[model samples]
Target: MKQVHLAAILCLGFIPYSLTACHAQNKTSQELNKSPEAANSTSETVTTPSSTQIQQAYKVNNIAEFNEPWAITPLKDGRLLVTERKGRLYLFDPETKKKTEIKGTPKVAYGGQGGLGDVALHPDFANTPWIYLSYAEQGQGGYGAVVIRGKLDLKQSTPQLTQIEKIWTQVPKFSSGQGHYGHRIVFGPDGKLWISSGERQQFDPAQDMKSNAGKIIRLNDDGSIPADNPFMNQGEIAQQVWSLGHRNPLGMAFDPKGQLWVIEMGPKGGDELNKIIKAKNYGYPLVSNGDHYDGKPIPDHSTRPEFEAPVLDWTPVISPSDLNFYTGKMFPQWQNKAIATGLSSKAIIIIDTMQQPAKEVQRLDMKARIRGAVQAQDGGIWVIEDGPQARLLKFTAL
Candidate 1:
């Protein structure tokens, strides 16, 4: 794999709130007003350009680099833990600018969107030293995303995983090579593990409670379903489902006030940022702001107000990948803002939540396919790129 120097890429400063710039240049009012079928037909013919030529903010800098870095999390000692799509985890020291490959990760099925995905620290990591990982496990005829928890041993010259246990798995895996395995793992404030499973590109499975393919699943720290779960009493519905009707949700995080938030990719042009509530069904195939890739119409969320609506929706989707709520001292002005990594837009979107009905405050384009972002203990923001030549980048206020 090719490796690029971190300093080669530029780092754009945050756009002040006063700027009213919009990122959806290709989408027009006519397209937005068109019927779903008509809109879908037009979008099918409109090809999207790759990141190499996409326009972005001209001022961002890349601080560090990595190989196909997919997820990034901070350790207690101020070092960063990054995961590669090929199944290797690494320790990146910012001060020393060094990288150490970790050992003992489970073998992964790493090809065509399946691989070792998100890595996160346990909520009580300081006391337990436990870390959670989500990856695509190859078995039988295909692959499925699985979640595992293990202890990280840094005592050795190179850190390694120990006591790795499979906590959850997607049952009845499909053969589709490009299914959206939305495999992000987060620890809710209630000490429950919340995971977003994609619909596996199957429209019908999302509405099927019997299948775990497309649901937000909740489990206890030990991978057991909580007795008080919304569907615990239901005979057939999986006891682990917290909510349903999600398509390729890549980002999930909890705000300071304990509100659980998620962002998922829509079919044609509807990207959504939703605040997840207990037992609430966010309409998916039944209703979407975007249309199908084959130019088919899906109902709009406005038609079904009973289902939870996204707090914010993007018409020409930015392909949001990672989500983080900023509450650090390095940028006090950005406190309580939602920082999202953008793949299609090649930027970091800052949504200011301090105000009622949070809005996209700024879109600071980094000119790279940003995959994951996390706030460091000292308040600096860290981001990872999503490519074979991905890099670990840090952002500081100018």
Candidate 2:
């Protein structure tokens, strides 16, 4: 393991920002005011000044490498499960530095931001051993995100998924384009399955209750609609919705207090960090701190009081990829905080979610497009880089 030095403090200042859409490939890319129109509302921006000083914060170990690696999670037995964007899965043993490819990952519609996505273990995995996966698939219209689960059979010579079953799917496959398929999935503390389905870059669907796009979905662990879901009476499609009006909500996590939060990519500016509320409308296409790619202006959240506003937003988009709340002993200072991986910003943003309105406190520069970050069993952090030949890095105390 090599000791990595991280800049401890980054002095804040204003910098000009240009808006552009970013994907896995090349695309060029916060604080203080509480006002929705205040583009500088972020307590700090991820764009660090060149004069910032550096210091050692943690020792980083390159655990393994994968092609276009996306999400990662630790298993009960100390092994790690990682997903590759091109429809592949690997079971990695950290202690042995060995990676075993797990078979049976469904073929994905792998192109233009659509591919294998998040991987999560069943909350009751010790007994059930069910593993869940989210990915993009090609259909009649175009492409859409889908979630599936299966029992992980490890006793065989090759670890593979069995009895795979589809749990949820983004209805009405979008023909708009191949962007913003937010297939992020998480199991809430209440044992309900939660999913963030992006609007597929289509404006109107975010506010359309008839479609499941651009909404947060909640369901029973077995893929059945929960009786108490906020929109149970809306329709079969709306029955799965927990909340509506979101853009590309790529990350979601529950804090120590069990409150859920999401980090999503905003337009040219206005990346958002939202505290999700059940059945609330986040006012995406209708209202945003950002504007359309064509430079069309969208009203600020402040203009619409009925719609929910983000607790924190960034002027120069962070292009946040994934999120995890720190609840570990290794980094006491980061305890109960939100760790958001940045793609365009190329850093790990640490936010104080416990505050009245969550604010960014620090950024750990990785100098690479970060796809995801998760807590290790020992209270350290495992970070994955984006795109081809991506490295899986483990971060522990210095």
Q: Write the per-residue lDDT of candidate 2 for residues 1-398, one digit (tens) a residue.
A: 11112223453233323112222221322111111112222122233332232222455666677788878998767789999988999999999988899998898998778889999888989789899999999988889999999889866679999899999989889876877889999999999899999989887888999989999999888899999989888899999998999999999999988999999988767788999998999998888887777778889888999999999887656789999998988877778889998887777788888777677776665557788999999888898888776777887885
TM-score of each: 0.85, 0.87
In terms of lDDT, model 2 sits at 0.80
- Per-residue lDDT of model 1, residues 210-305, tens digit only: 877778989988898899889877653479898888888989999999988998888877788888888888888898888887778888888899
Candidate 2 wrongly placed segments (more than 4 Å): 1-56
The TM-score, computed over Cα atoms with residue i paired to residue i, of candidate 1 is: 0.85
Q: Which window of ten consecutive residues has the lowest lDDT sum in model 1? A: 35-44
Clashes of 2: 9
